[model samples]
Structure formats: structure tokens, C-alpha cells
Target: MISRMLVKMIAVLWVGIAAGWLNPAVSYSEEASEKVLKLHSGLYYTIQKGDTLWDLSERFFDSPWVWPDLWQKNSQITNPHRLYPGEQIRLFSREETQTMVVESRPEPEVAVEPQEPPYYFYPPINSVGFIKERPVRPSGAIFKVKGNKAMISYGDLVYIRPIGRPTFTPGDRFTIYRVLEPLKDGEIKADVGIQHCILGLVEITEGHPKFAMGRIVQSRQTIELNDLLMPYEARSPKITLTQSKKRLEGKIIASEGHERIFGDQAVVFIDKGRQDGVRVGQSYYIYEQEKERLDSKKKEDLLLSPVDYGDILILHTEETTATALITRAEKTVRPGARIRSPF
Candidate 1:
């Protein structure tokens, strides 16, 4: 009887140890099985004094309008335009996730206009030769600090000197013509054509003067300037028509690297250009597509909506594509993304 009891106790002890070992192995295997998913992630930074949504987006995502997508995902945010201190934002992955819970509130609805598709026009790249001209002196001259006062006031005939720069050889000759108006209160204001002009070029001259200066020769009948020697030139006018609305898309071709112009603002480059209807001042929206949950259920219940990551504005455009200053950014604008017209 004693031997049988001891055997039974030993057998029970062995069984307990085996069970403990198996349970731990199973638990560890289950825990390790959890998979990590990588998706595009964005962070919401709180607004502080002297902060605009434009700059904030650039700081966080490298684009400004990216706030819209963030706003779209976080329905808890009642107001999109204004943000309060200590607000929380949810970061979503490319994989589907739970829909954000927003309180039942009647939100104002706005209609989104359909944007026109972009048209591509390829202009032959050609090198042309033209004569360089020298600027003539105007009748009168004005003295003001460079940034303090308008360098060339509206309707003021000023001589532009190409100070021996590589682009402007010593003997290059160019002509200057007066535009629509004269300088006002020391500032020039005029609408020349596609570009708004304030001061008119009266002449182009070679060689830089010790002190850069401009003189107004022919002022409107009532216009008068201090008795200063001015520049002179014959006036010729030309009119150009502005292009209508158009759309274009392209990827980032290059970058100007990083710069801190105003606080943390930066500028970057793209691959689209004038051939694609991109001009000097055209605006575009930068976007990166993200996979999101879609409400597949055929019921009148809340569902997931397809969304994108971020957006930005274009500053300068070229023929194939143009370089854009990151006006607004949500997340970091990376290479190999799509930039399209917002409209």
C-alpha cells in the first residue's frame, strides 16, 4: 500500500510539471503570433500663439491642407477651422481600423466642386538669341532705403543696371518702356498684363553704379518728384492674355533640400512643367493615397470613408512640372507621391 501511494504521488507530480511547461510554451507562442502592421501615420500638433494652420501642417506633415484629412478622420473635432489646446488626435494606419466615434451633432454641409482634369502641352525646348540692351536715365530721381521704400514706384521710369553679372555682360544693351501708371507716394502701382507692375523700366544699362539709383523722367502732368536726375527711355507696350483654368499632375522630380525661410517653412521641387500646362503661379494639391476601411454593409448605419494623407500648394511651376513651396503639409511629403490640381 505504501509503495503504491508513493508511486501515485510521483506520477501526479510529473503530470503537473509537464502541464506547466506546455502552458507557458503555448502562451508565449500565442503572444509572439501578434503581427505588427505598418501604415502611413500622421501626428496632430497643438496650435500655439503665432501659429497658422499652414505653418503647422508644414511642421508636422510637410504640407498644410493635410489638416482636412486629419479633420475628416477625427469626427470628434466639431470645428475644423479652429482648434483648442490639449486636443487629442488619432493616428490611423494604412490597414483598416475602427471608425472614429463622434458625438451626434448636426454639422454644416458644404458642396465640393468637381475639379477639371489636367491637360498636357509639350512645348519644344529651343534656345534663342536676343540682343541685350542698356537702360537709359529717367528725368527725376528718388532716394529711399531698399526695403523701406518701393525701389521703383508706379509709373516711375527707372533704369535697370545689369551690374557686370555673368548674365549681363558689360556691353549688353536692353530697352526700358513705361507701363500703365506712375509711382504713388514713392511707390509704383500698375497692372501691366499677366503680372501686376508698379514701376516701369525706362532703360537697361551695363555696369553697376556705386550707389544703385532710379530717376523718374516723364511723370503724369500732375506728378512731381524731388529735383533728382532720372532715367530715360522710349515707351513700348505689349499685351498678353492670361491662360484659363487647367489641371496637371506630376511626381516630385527633385528637391531644393531643406530651408527655414519663415520659422520652419521649406521649399521643394517637382517633375511637372510648362509642357503640362504648369505656369509660374499655378496652384496644386499634393496627395498620398491611403487604404482605409469602407462601409460595405448595405444599411443606414455609420460606415468608413476612403481618405488620403496630406496636401500642399505650388509656388513656382515649370514646363514639365514646377518647384513648389510647401505652403501646407500634414505629414512629411516624401518622394514618389502624386501632386494634382486642387480644383
Candidate 2:
């Protein structure tokens, strides 16, 4: 009897070893297989001003046509054309896994439904022209005021009054402009009175052919009737096109104090506009005019050396002027600084 029991015990031990039930390494491997798996497979993007779904899709997915699907899946955006800046987008994996457990309870009957195979569709490989269906105007247009004497104080009620034949309706948005002095011979001269300050934004509360009323939501100073207002219109700012694009030059017409939120904001009246191929969201470097330096050893010796002051990010564009936000500043940027496209 003892011999027979020993033989049975040995057989049971061998079976456990062969099945990997008695080995810690085998047990660990199985445990690892059962655990959930994750992957770093997503992109995080921060939306910038004037960025469109089509532009973003073209940048990331290699196709702008796929923008509609991405917008539908990722955002609560009803209109694919409109996208706000400062919004965050995260793309994550969709795969998931579940584990099964056994118990003594009676099994319940379950029904299984057949699933159809997914259809595959490929987007076109060619680059498609991105044209606006309607010309994009400034958000607040008809209610803008125009004049050099508009006194804009902080916390003042601002409005955009339409002038001449009305091109905008009620509830339409427009942009406001502070009148700036003209550039002379590719040089911008800073005159205290000519430097226009952004008072605030206004919305059209009422509309008419000759004028419109708007409520001011923001202002750097108190707004008065003397301040000139330009209503936001969708039309591209006017520009004069030259035969040679390489010979074009950038001009700064006005300068404002540094913004607490945007760091610094500068008003540039470029010779180029929509007609000249100047588009919104274009970036330019602000180069301070080369200081005229004289050698101490020889008073007659003069040197023209260019200094880089900062960079400007274009925000709004008009036929005559473009508003830009300063991104990097080594020193205060003055009027007449040269702005060039980045290489």
C-alpha cells in the first residue's frame, strides 16, 4: 500500500511541473499576459489664433479633406469652419480589453448579433485649394467709428456706428481701428498723437443704412466720440500689387503699449495687403533699424548695423494696416522697425 501511494504522489508532482503550475516564472508570465496593456499613442495640440480645421488636418493627417470627420469625433463644434484659439485637442487610442471570470451560479442564455465589416474609404492624395465661400470680414463691422479725436478711456461704453451705405446687418461682428499716421518713405515715425490705442470691442445692437450702434466689451482706456472706429468686415484689406514680390517692403505705422495678456501689441501698416498676398496668421520678424554708429578714432567713419528687437505675430489684417502681437522682445520695439518674413 505504501509503495502504491508514493508512486501516485510522484505522478501528480510531475504533471504539475509539466503544466507550469509549480514554476514561479511560468506563473508570472501568465499574470503579465492577463494584465491590461496601454500605449502612448496620442497627440496633444494647442489651437492658435486663425487656425481652421482644414489647416490643422492638413498639418497632422496629411490631408485637409479628413477634417470633417476629425471635427465630428473630437469636438462639440457644430460648424467645421469656426475654431477658437487656446482650445486643447487630445487624440487617444480607442482599443479596450475585458477579462472573464467563472462562478458556480447558473449560466444565463445570451444572444449574439452578427456585425458587418467596416467599409474602407481613402481620402484624395492631391492638395486641394482652400477657398473661403464668403469673404471673411472683421467680426464687428458696421458699428465702427472713425475719427482722430475719439477719446477712449478705460471702462467706457463703446459702439460701432455704420457710415454711408450699410454693408452689415444687426448682430454682425466687426473690427475697430485706431487711426494711425501714414508711413513716409518706408519709415514709420512715432508721433504721440498718431499712435492709436485699442479702446475695446463692440457689438452691433441696432443697424441702419447710415449708422449702427454697438456695445463696447473691452477697452484699454475710456472711449469718447473722438476715437475713430472701423467696423469689422469680411472683405480683405485693400493692397497694391507690384510686379516683383521680392522687392516688397514692410512698414510699421503705429505702436501701442505692451499688453498684459499678449505681452506687446504693435500696429503695422504694410504696403502689402490681401491683394499683395499678405494673409492673416502670417509671422514676421521685427528688426530694429540699424543704429548709425560713428567710430571714436575717426569721427567721419559711420557703420550701419541692424539690430533684432523682437518678433511680431499678425492678428488682424486690413487693406491698409495689420495688427500684430509681439511674441519675443529683447528691447522695446519702436516705430519704423523693419518686419521681414522668416526664412
Candidate 3:
């Protein structure tokens, strides 16, 4: 009787193991269901498996780059990087009292205070293009690319050669860029400056007397062979809004991506810069020139008053030009659009 019972138990255990192995989908479902407990609902999110600040920000706020705003909005979360399952994340706050009910029990009333708005604007400093008044004096050039590819991006390795002197060292960083063309003012029909489009960033991993090897750390666009390298200067994206004291006006000379028409959140270039008292973080109004046709011998023309249609915020400034981002617009903003300070 004891031997018969032992044999029966062994048969049951073997059957269970075989079932689990044969039905792989069932095993996968059980593993997947263990990760998540609940989903987000009504101004609150119950943290689940694979939930991150970036993902939550992108899901709720419509942008992954605005994760800092999400972190600033929540006061209960201690660490921005680490989130545990079953934890609570406040999506946003309201001025009124918040009531939470759980498991048929009512929790205490929590009053949420209104927070002040942010004054500084964060722009993508490295990805935007700028107008250079003079020719670019490159530090080096990317001669060869690794991994049998012509175009490279983030984390790709490339060999660089110095232009005049070899001053590259391990851990040295450089900005990769390429000259697009000479930006010319459409109104004046003259060349304003050279336009340089930022490609990516690289850091030296191995340095030699004549040549150095580096890996691409950050890429805004595709990095190609013979891309010019410049000394990288780390700049903060945060720029405080400042009231302009001078009444300045300029015309949009060009825009990023060379698009003929661009609107909100698009990066553009203006003819005004530091020489014209243009500073970063200053806001400008975009205006459209109004014209009227006169019926003369050959149908003469008359210029009317300009009308404001949009707003632009300055991001970076050169000697004679400035890079700006369109903040608000109700009409089409394009090249030759006028820009004036708000005073």
C-alpha cells in the first residue's frame, strides 16, 4: 500500500511539470499578471511594473522631455528615478480638497495648495541651429567611422584627426556640425551669415599624437564622415525670462529645417542679435506686414501697418543673429515675418 501511494504522488508531480512546460502561454500570462496591480484613474496613478517618470510624463503630459515638470508637480514622491509597485503618483493638483476612498473606507481630507508657475524656459540648446557671422574654425574632422557604416548616430565610434595641433585627450568632448549654406536676408537680398546645423556630440576615448578615437555620446542628427568638430561648451537649457528695456525690431531671416512655413514650437532665426541688444529669454511679438494695392498707371502698391500674430522666445544669440522658438501663434509664421520686443 505504501509503494502504491508513493508511485501515485510521483505521477501527479510529473504531470504538473509536463503541463507547465507544454503550455508556455499560460506560464507567460502568470508572469505578466504578477507585474501590474492597478492602472491610473482620475488624477492619480497607481504605480505598476515598468512605470517610470519619463513614461508617466509622456503618457499624462504629452511629452517625455517634460519629466522635470512632473517631478516638480508631485511632492509625495521622494525619488524621481525609483518607483515601487503599489505606490501612488499624483497626476496633478487642484485647489480644492481631495478625498480618496479605498477598500470601503474613507481617508482623511487632503488640501492641495496651488503652486506658482515656472518663469524660466527650457530649450533644446544642442539641437537648434545658429547663424555664424564668420567662417567656422573647426578643431578637427571625423575621418573614419567604425562598424562599416557611413552615417553614424549615438554611441557609434569614429576616428578623428586634428586640424593644426594635436591637443585631444581622453574624455575630451566636441560638438559635431556641418555648414548648410550662407543665410541671406530676403528683404535686403544680401548674405547675413553662415548657417551651421548641429549634428551630434562626441567624446574622445583613445587619443594619439596624430589621430584620436571617440564615441558619439549624443546625436541630434546623423553624424557623417568629414563632419567638422568644435570644442563643446556645456550650457544650461534654462533661461530666465527678462523684460527688454530697448525697443528692438528685426525680421526672421531663416528657420530650422529650412521649412518655408513654421509655427508654434518651431525654432527660427532672426536678424537681430547681441549687437542689436537682443538677449536670450526675451520674448518678441511676430507681426505680418499688411499691404494695399493702389490703382495708378501700373497699379502701384502701398505698405500698411504690421499686425501682430504670434510670439517668439529667444534661445541663443550670436553676434549678429539670434535663434528663437515660436511660443504662441494664431496665424502662419514664416520667413520675412517681423519681430519686435514687447517693451
Candidate 4:
């Protein structure tokens, strides 16, 4: 019992020392935007010019990486950089600050940069895509081309049969996609959802109710026969840095550039989406499973920890999948890589 109290006291003292490093500076900007703020038992220190969250977290937590928890605690500062120069951040006692600690460590000689390369040993959850359940089938596939061409490009004419019927208004628009590959599933079935590459968009100009005539209006990639079509829906979700409430495990199912590998700012698709509780603005860390490597000198295999690339932020979410931008990556990221929450 005495040891427990001693441990707790040491923890609080450590935190107090860390928090003491920050000195209050008056916030100067009046036009700057303010965010949601949390109430805690601490003195208020106004933000000032040249101040960065990294600096503040380091000052208060002794480790710059705790900024996310700091943001979460404050909640009001939606954008870390948009902190109003004049806004006040409440500083709290060490005991109170203990609630914000995501990780604890002994005192170190060097200060670490929170946003530096390989921000986490494991990627966060939002960046990892997950599919909790099988997704519904798309509208239909490109049955045949106007000239019966196997492949078609922008402005090409095409015909499509609604998944089961030819019952659509002639002027409806649809997004076209090429089925890429199937993802991991407990069981394999032809009807199960698979990763898809959006080929282009088509607008029905003329044709029968069951079979419609349409023209490829825009093509990010060449359109081809048998490419599936989905009802087009305009989307533009406001994405911000957000935290996940629950731990979710998922993988990168697809990528936008169709590149063999991805890196920072590269858009990728995850298997998890809205139904799985993933939302736009949430972030995740990307990592590849640790593998055993051959050591030439020892002539033996050495196991290495999972390689952390960096974080990915969910830009958009659908029913069973989400698209994310790899906001940071220390190494090349690729589909099948895993993602999870940092905390």
C-alpha cells in the first residue's frame, strides 16, 4: 500500500514538473478562430504567436507526442495550427494532468518531435480500413461497348443493364468501376464485396429501360467492359484530425493512384467504413507485420517489430469501406498493410 502511494506521488510530481515548463503568454490574435475547450483544474494561459501545439505538449507533458491527448482534452481547438494567438489554455495540476497522459516514460535527455517521421510504432485506427460485413452489390457492370470494344476511354459510348433489370431513367448518371481484387474474408464467395477501382463516370443519354445508352463523361482511368457501375452520389466531407473511441483493426484494401506502393499523401481505401464507426477526420497509423529477417553474420533469422509507416486520415467513408489520405509515412505503404489506434 505504501509503494502504491509512493508511485502515485512520484507520477504526480513528474507531471507537475513537466507542466511547469510552460509559461503563460497572452494570445494576440482577435480574428483567429477558437475551438471547443474542456474544463479542468488548472490556471489559464493564453496562446501566443510562434506557439505550436508540439511546443505546448512538450512543455506540459514532457513529450511532444502527447499533443493529441492535449487536443482531445481541450477539444475546442479543431485545427492544431489554427490555435487563436490570444486564446487561453487552462493549465492544470499534475494530478489533473495525469488524465491526459497517453504514454509514460522516464526522463530523457533529448526532446522528441511528436510529428516527426514514424510518429507511432503502430498506425492509428482511422487510417486502417475495415469492412465489418459484406457490402451490397453495385448497380451493374458495363455489359458491352457501343462498338463492342473490350476497352473504352473518355467520351466513349457504352451500354449497361441494371444489376437485375433495365429499369432506370434514361438520364441518370452512374460511377463506373473495375473490380480489382477480393479482400480477406472469413469465407470466400462470389457475391462477397471486393475492392474496386473507379474507372470513370457515365451519363445515360438514351436507351431502353432495362438496357441504357450512356457516354463516359469523365475518365480517371480507361473504362472497360464488365466494369461495375454504382449510382453516382456527390460527396465532399469536411475532414479534420479526430480520435477513435474504440480500437479497430483493419487493412488497406485498395489505392487511388493504382500504384504498386503508396506513400505520404497517397490516397488508399480501407475495409472499414461508416457502419464500422469510422468517420471522416479520424486518423490511423499504417504498419506492416513484423517479419523475421536473415542475419548474414549469424546465419539466422531475426524477428523485427512491425514497421510503422505513419498516420492516415479518413477523408471519406461509405457503408463498408472508407478512403483515407496517408497523411504521414516513413516508408512506402501498400495494400494489405495493417492500421490501428495509437492509444
- Number of backbone collisions per candidate, in order? 52, 40, 0, 21
Cα lDDT computed for each candidate against the true fold: 0.36, 0.44, 0.71, 0.61
Ranking by TM-score: 3, 4, 2, 1
Q: How many angstroms is residue 18 displaced in model 3 relative to the true structure, after the best TM-score fit?
A: 36
TM-score of 2: 0.37
lDDT, model 4, position 236: 28
What lDDT is obtained when candidate 1 is compared to the true structure?
0.36
Better of 2 and 4 by lDDT: 4
* Residue lDDT tens for model 4, 1-343: 3344345435645644665532222132233223212222344555767778898766545567767666654533546767766555555544544443423433466676566332222212222222324443778778888777766865577888778653456567777765544555323322225555656667777767567778765555667778777787644223445677378888776576557787876778777888889887788878777656576677567667766668888766778778777878998777677898776
Residue 38, candidate 4: Cα error in Å is 54
User: On residues 41-126, what C-alpha lDDT tens digit does candidate 3 reach at each position?
Assistant: 11344567788889766554445776886665543354678877755454432211122111224457779868644455453565
What's the lDDT for residue 238 in model 2?
Answer: 19
Q: Which has the greatest lDDT? A: 3
Alpha-carbon runs more than 4 Å astray in model 4: 1-135, 185-193, 246-260, 271-276, 287-309, 318-321, 334-338
* lDDT: worst 10-residue window of model 1: 123-132
Candidate 3 off by > 4 Å = 1-52, 55-66, 69-118, 292-305
Taking the tens digit of each residue's C-alpha lDDT, what string does model 1 give over 1-343? 3344334334433443565421111222333112211112322233344444454444334467666654545443445566554333443321222121122234687698686445321110010001112222333333342344444432243333333331322323222232232211112232111111112222222234432343322121222222233222222111112342356566553334322222112445556555667664455666655554456564445434323444444444434445555546666665555677665
Clashing pairs in 3: none
Q: Is candidate 2 or candidate 3 better by TM-score?
A: 3
